[model samples]
Target chain A: MKTRIDQCLERLRKTRRKAFIAYITAGDPGMAETVDSVVQLAGAGADIVELGVPFSDPLADGRVNQDAATRALAAGATWGRLLKCIEQIRRKSPIPLILYSYLNPLISRGFEKTARQATAAGADGFLIVDLPAEEMEPYSRILGRVGLNNICLVTPTSPSARIRKIAGLASGFVYCVSREGVTGMQKQLASSALGLIRRTRRWTRLPIALGFGISTPEQARAAAREADVVVVGSAIVNRFAAAPKTAAGRKAAAQWTARLVRAVKEV
Target chain B: MPRKRIDTEPDAHGHFGPYGGMFVPETLMAPLQDLEREFRAARRDPSFRRDVEYYLREYVGRPTPLYFAERMTRELGGPRIYLKREDLCHTGAHKINNCIGQCLLARRMGKKRVIAETGAGQHGVATATCAALFGMQCVVYMGKVDMERQALNVFRMRSLGAEVVPVTAGQQTLKEAISEAMRDWVTNVRTTHYVLGTAYGAHPYPVMVRTFQSVIGREARRQILKQEGRLPSALVACVGGGSNAIGLFYPFLQDRGVEMIGVEAGGLGIRSGKHAARFADGRVGVLQGTRTWVLQDSEGQIRLTHSVSAGLDYAAVGPEHALLRDLKRADYSHVTDREAVDAFYTLARWEGILGALESVHAVAWLMKNARRWGKKDLILVNLSGRGDKDVQQVSAWSAKHGGPKA
Candidate 1:
């Protein structure tokens, strides 16, 4: 089966507009809301949905995303529960799902087991938040063997020479961190990401997705104009915090996710 | 597999057994690739070691003396105590021992700048010293809280032409400072070297740091043989990221007669969960780059750690210690906040040596356990840093506790 990363990119290029990639932390409040949010993202025009695996110390994340992860983890989010959410999301949503996590959880789960499980759970790829490209051999091999795309990250700080190296190794799409800090709602994407995206284009035909600090629809729309996929994460997770503690709260969160997807997909 | 070691290889993906591996985010891949290649080449070059060794001895004052703590040992009423006097080294700590070595490598690599994270501010002071010595631009990131507590050191860094950036995020502690430093390294890998404070982080770092710090053990081993004609019965030091302990323990690790013990800060109390006792609570995991004992939740999120000493307030131990623990090569324990405070006073009054709270934990351990060993039994503790900087904090804390009036 063609991985969701591949399909999403293919559809995105044909559409002329950008791929709407929405992000939500797993088990934010509870697992049901998380799963519902994923499906809602798909229904609301998100070409792909990134599911953040909560970790205690998200060194790469900004304040907003970090707080979201803490909230999710405190609510009893576990690897098993996250996997179950992915499985449930796959039952309804055909949009590609990427498991965004730090290297520690995968190490504990055993990379091979995580790869196989992620693939089986209908995860098209993994965006290892901490597994930089130089150390990609073991993870990429496992991901390739399991038919899962091992997504790589390229940052605005990445030099031209390194950009070529990252684009070559990247599967799915390259996650271009628009800023030096972790994922959060930024006032704007870094001006350097555009140059990075252009440099990355010289190396690979693969889609380049802009993330980290892309929160507002205008920012997403601006970022979308420059890249194949515009990725938003902390914004979706933040919405759940404001929702009520009930079934309607979860649906409301799902609706919020859908709205984000629609906003990003707007031409 | 019974897991023969405390650390594993493939770098969590599968590289060195415990002490070597890479654990960074995907965004850092390209830079790390460049670093790994350069490091592999640097390690193989004989001149690299020669230059590092020369600077370590001449610049940072290597072969730091191991002085027998005659007064404190007699008062403690048991084993003879010796101090690996890193406090007497340039800049007043063992931190410069590694900084000098790393700075030389950075120069050789043609790097133009140095960046470092400071907890107690010792390492930042050390890094700034080296950067100034090398004529390189230096930036030091320290938690805002630490900058306040260690204002003198902050001023010292600025005097050495280093920019001290105060990190205000999160708990405003060492962990956040490290996070900010790593981000800076990733962003400026082309021209900057991150002078990591401890023997932790990704592959090569744990190994490189230990290698640089090995002089502590080498000198102590030689001094003991020349002075007392035999090895000590016990070796002790505080464990923040376990570098100082590793530095002192490396040469003695294979010697069965020498007992190696690491003391972690049992801040206030272990049960309070506000201590930097990684061995007591941390499990084997990867953070930054290497597999080590880390105090993290089930989801592998790094937790906020606490300690009276900024240097000891780390959430992970060096990978070598993790391996040593698994192999049963060392005994790791903790001393309570009250006990450490008591030891601090004892050192000042009995020995006239003011000790860092991080180092006080080791003193506390020796004081608490001196009676258990025979009179002839010798114990050596790595006094990793001096306490001159902590005088104010200690005085204030003592006043609050109703001790000798501040």
Candidate 2:
């Protein structure tokens, strides 16, 4: 049986429409709000939902996502709680969910056990920000055994050889970083991103998802034109963090996500 | 039965047993691989070795005296104590040894810029000094709290033509500073070499730093043999990331007669949850690009660590130390903040040798265990740095907590 992520991307390819992946820190504001936001994001046309597991030292994240993680961690987010939130979301919706995390938490739990538990909890895959392609062999084996995807990342600095290696290991999609820095919303997409997408296409048949620094609808539209999917994180996370408690804030977040989804789908 | 030899370790993948692997982001993988290639090539080149040796001999002042602490030995009247005076190095600490070597590597690699992260500012100052000497651009990331506490060293770093960037994230400490440095390296990997300050981090780093710092052990070994006609009974050094301790311990690992002790910082006490004793309180986990013993909560979030000495205020130890502890080759212990302070005063008063607060942890351990050794036994300690930069902080701490009675 195909995984939910693979099926979602395959279906999107057939429709000639790009996938819109939305990222938010789990347990931000609170767990209940996290569940509500994921459902709202899916309702707003997010083909895949990326739930960030909050870590104290999020080196790859910019100020916006970092603050979101800090808030979630402060609100008592744990690995167990994140899984529970996933279970809650699974009950309500069949959205393809990816657990985005740093490597320590998974290493602490033992990779095989974490992968098994996450698979059982209905998570489709994982995106470990710090696990380099070179060190992903054991993790890939564990994830493969559990029939889950281990999403691999490609960067602007990634050489062609490295890109091919990562592409070979990637299961669901290749995350192409739009810029060289951490995750954040930028006013303009990086000029080098187009070249990266073109280079990555030569190596993998899997869908390419461009993320990092993609914020505006125009940027999302442009990214959708070049890649199979576009991931918008910091902008959506910034909305919920600005006013975590109020209904109006969540409505604004959902509205912005829908706008991004609409722009990507139009491409 | 003979003990196993400790020379052939870390293997090819940088694993000291189950610990130590390159646990960095994909962005850093290419750079780390490039660094490893350059480092391996440089190690085999005689010219590179010559350049490092020249800098060590002239610029950084190597072969620092290994002195017999006659007064302390007489006072203790149990074990004869000697001091390896890394405090006499040009930058006032042993951090210069690794910095000079890395700076030389950067120059040889044709990199124009070097970046580093520092905790107590010793590594920052050393990197800045080397950069000035080599005419390379240097940038240092330091925690805001550390910058305030080690303001003198901050000024020293800036005066040496280094840009000091204060990191204000996650309790504003060494771990945060390192994260910031890693970010900078990722963004500027094309023209920069990260001068990681300790014997930690990715594969080539721990090995490279240890190779550069093993000069301390080599010198101490020759000096002790020349003076006492034999190896010392014990070798001790404070283990903050384990560079100094590893430097002193690496050469003597094969000597079954020498007992190596690594002293970690016990802020309040181990049970108090306010300490940097990774082996005692930390579990095996990956952080800052290597799998080592790290202080973390149940959910695997890195914990905020505490130590009177900023240099030792880190959550993780070097991976080699973890392996050593697990193999039972070296014993690990910790001294409380109060005990370290008392040792600082004791060394200053009795021997007229002021040491960094980080190094005093080793001295504190010796003082506590003095009665266990015979009068004929000899102990060697790595006095890792001078206390000039610490006098202000130490005085303020003393005023608030009342001076140690010792």
Candidate 3:
């Protein structure tokens, strides 16, 4: 009787290893590379892949992620195209996919329709970077019915009571926003994420995935040692953003994703 | 319609919604947080409010008069028009209304410098006036194009002892000036207060600014009741960051019969795909601060907008205005660049007083809709600022009318 998200979490727990959460911006530079990167992450040992859907004003993001989103948006990334890329990746890969976005896109796309389309495209869950639990009922209702989990973000600043409330609504796993700023490749993970993990433990038994500043293999190793899942986004998106928009560029980016995924998955 | 308790994110500190939050590099976050904490305490102190109000009334010119435009009303042969005369304030516009309040807050927070972004240069002049009054270091970031268009105001700010930093990045316009001001704020968060010209941006700001500017609508409502015995049938104003429109609309928002109309600059035309009509063409998104409607592409890049008036050409509309539109409390519309220019000239000829090009968009709608209203019906427009700064553009407009053959 386990939900798809609960099953995903159980799978991660039984492995008892750090679940590699490979993060890449959806349609950075181009859609073709985005599809290739997702597949490569799955093939190379990423337990779960977080596909960042770019927004114009990512208030929560740091500078690096903001630049990546601006580049992707400038190159013609759209929701329809991003969904199409997810559909293409699902055709051949069974990687647990989570679409990460801000509130505006979901509201604009009509919450019910977007949830249905996301489920149809094989997306397992969603993490709306800005929509907190207090304002989540409208969106959570539609997502709940479609068997797609709504991932909640618990920041270092969130009170223990707020953490429990957020965890009560979350299904897949609780995404611990490891630090204050937006998602970016950082040299060091704040020790604060450990404290947040310990605090959230009081709220629910859901697995906690640490994100928002994890960059290198060493940082990933540290985060993995503490939490059930280690999320890496800006570093992978940087590779895709820097690569040229061509067949060769996508191949190179995929190779890059494979290398990062390998580091996080080591037993 | 259940009202959920509004919550604030810890990382946001003092920012409102998504629009008003701290986004400085790692080094400046602590100082920004300190400034915000101090501002919070100072804001609650009654003595601080009394001191600021004393200065606002005696110095910055609070409670500007409400004038009924009988001549224009008779000529239009329909609705009577009234103007909340914000242009008569000390700095010649509503811009100074918030500047005085921020200068006081900056002094209490112990900040010694003031920086601002200017498009029409009205805000720069207003900020410069406060800096001179407070003897603080004032640096105004103005786009090169605006600096050229409003050269006299540039000279005016310098005369007031403020340095004008001409910005030439991105589009060479107001949008670029804002980007540069943000960069400046990031570098100097400890000693600088970005006197945002409108009611937008992170959390406390939208609320703080609206509170400061609310005096306009407050005074207008009382004056209208005393002079005309009831509120007007419609309220009209031009919206850039929407401060003036908000100033005129806030007190009347609950009045079921009062209609609020915000006129956006439609550049050439909305259908021509070039205008500053965020509500007309933009999707709901977050920008600068607060969740609002913005002119952005699918990937969330803020797009460059065009308008004949420098002050009205912003890619994002204010967050409160977005909420009002969503609730159907106000009607948002557009006026073409050509129509605005014609209205600007007509107003000068019809009335002895000239108006800023930014406010002419609203005047254009008034001219178009005047015939539809009955003789006794009334409309109140926020006559935001004077047109003296627009001589160069207006001279060229006049030359085209009579001076030379093209």
Candidate 4:
């Protein structure tokens, strides 16, 4: 059975259109408005919306995304409550959803419970940053029971043989990390980004999504040339991090982020 | 319980009975693999072994004497105790032994830049000193709060030509500094080698650090055999991340009758929920990188742990220690903040040795427990660091926790 993530990536590939994967903390400015922001991002043309379930120690993220997560958690984000937010978003939008997280939060809540709850909440998939495929078995087995894909991330530093192994283990689509580093905005895309995408292409027929250090629209459009999906994480989160806590303010932030998402969809 | 396999435990992937593995991002996987390959090759390389020995002797100073604490033994009136004087090492701690070896490995790997995360600044100072001697660029990440407390070591690290970055993330201590240093390594993996402070973290690190730190146990074994004519009844050391404890215990693991005890920080008390006692308060969870017993809240967030000693204030123990604890091969215990402080002064008064508060946890354990043993019952405590950097901390700790009296 194809999950929502698989469906979205397949649909995008069939349409000959690149997908824009906009990222944001599940409840950045306010928890009440997470459903609203995700809805607004979908309306703006995001093919897939990846929600970050805030963690206390987000070592894989740079300063901007880390602060965004801190703000989200301060506003009352939890594994249980964030799943509730996902259910709320599922009510208002059909946009494919992916929850970005670390291993601690899920392991703390018990993987089977979290995976079952996420599936019930209509969360499409997950990309646990710190959980390398080597330790994915126990969690993957639990996730597989609920029909969800645990996204595999391939970095520029990944050797060719491991790249093939990772791609073989991948389910929905492969996430190609454009550069070596935590998630953040960079002035330019790394020169090695294109090479990593080319290497990943040889191993899978699945759509390839590029992330990490891709903040600007120009970088996103350039990434879209060879990549099947372009992910904008810290870039979008940086927008709403300072937005006013009102619904209208968050809506405006979502619209501003949508413009970045929309520009890539035209690619 | 399984018999001690020593070096054979970690098994190819660095897992010690499900306690350790590479749990980092995909970006770090290749670098960790490269590090593991280079580390394994370096172990077999004669020049690499020669370089490490030369640095240990001429650069860091090795074969530190294992002295008999006659006064403390007399005071206890029952057991015989020996102090493996790691405090006398250059940079004032056993931390330098691993730093010198890792810095040399970094150079051999063709990496020109080295980075490390420090808690109480002991590791930071040692890393800075090695980087200076090796002429490699060094950056040390220290928590903002630790910088304020261990300000003396901060100055020492800076004076030795290393940039000490202040990490303000989460609890702003050792673990956060590690997270930030990981970020730096992820960004610059091509040219940077993260000189992890202790025997923890992902694959190769636990193996790499323990191998580097095993010198303490190696030296203690030879010294004790020559001085006492046999192995001590037990090997003891403070287990923050268990580097020093593992260092002193690894060489003696094969001795069937030689017991090993790792002392953790009891802080106020284990009941107070303000301690760094992972075995007492923690459950199986993943933190920073490795899978181990972690001091985490009910929601799985790594808890902010407290201890009088800054160095022993971390929330996790080494993965190998976790395996040993489960096997009952080594015993784990804790001493309260008050008890450790008193032991700090107790050692200073009796043996005229101002031991680091972290080291005194083991001494405090021996003081309270060793009295039950007879005069021939030997206990060797790893006094891992000198207390010069901690004098200011202990003085302030005295004013608040009451006088440091036995």
Candidate 4 per-residue lDDT, tens place, A1-267, comes to 789888888887788888888898877856667888888888778888999888788889999988888787778777767878888888888888998888888888688888888888998888888888777777777777788887889999999998998887777889999899999989999989999999999999988988888877788888988798999988778776677766677678778876677667778
Candidate ranking (lDDT, best to worst): 2, 4, 1, 3
How well is each residue in A96-182 modelled by candidate 3, as lDDT tens digits? 888888766766656788778888887888887666564577778778898888888887656677788889998878888777555
> Could you tell me every candidate's TM-score relative to the true structure?
0.83, 0.97, 0.78, 0.98
Greater DockQ among 1 and 4 belongs to: 4
Model 1 per-residue lDDT tens digits across residues A1-267: 578789768876787767878888788777887887676667667778888888766777776777777778778888888888888987887888888888888777578987788888888888887776666777788888999987888776677777788787788888788866556776867898788788888888888888888767778778878888888787777776777866677567667666556666676
Which predicted model would earn the best lDDT?
2
Candidates 2 and 3 compared: the better one by lDDT is: 2
Report the number of clashing residue pairs per model: 18, 0, 14, 0
DockQ for every model, please.
0.38, 0.71, 0.09, 0.85
Runs in model 3 deviating more than 4 A are: A1-9, A244-267, B1-45, B67-81, B99-208, B224-234, B253-259, B278-305, B314-332, B349-354, B372-379, B388-406
Q: Between prediction 2 and prediction 4, which has the larger lDDT? A: 2
lDDT of each: 0.81, 0.91, 0.77, 0.89
Model 1: DockQ score: 0.38
Q: Is the docking of candidate 2 incorrect, acceptable, medium or high quality?
A: medium
Tens-digit per-residue lDDT, B181-279, candidate 2 = 988888888899999999999888998899889999999999999999999999999999999999999998898889999999999999899999998
Poorest lDDT segment (10 consecutive residues) of candidate 3 chain A: A56-65
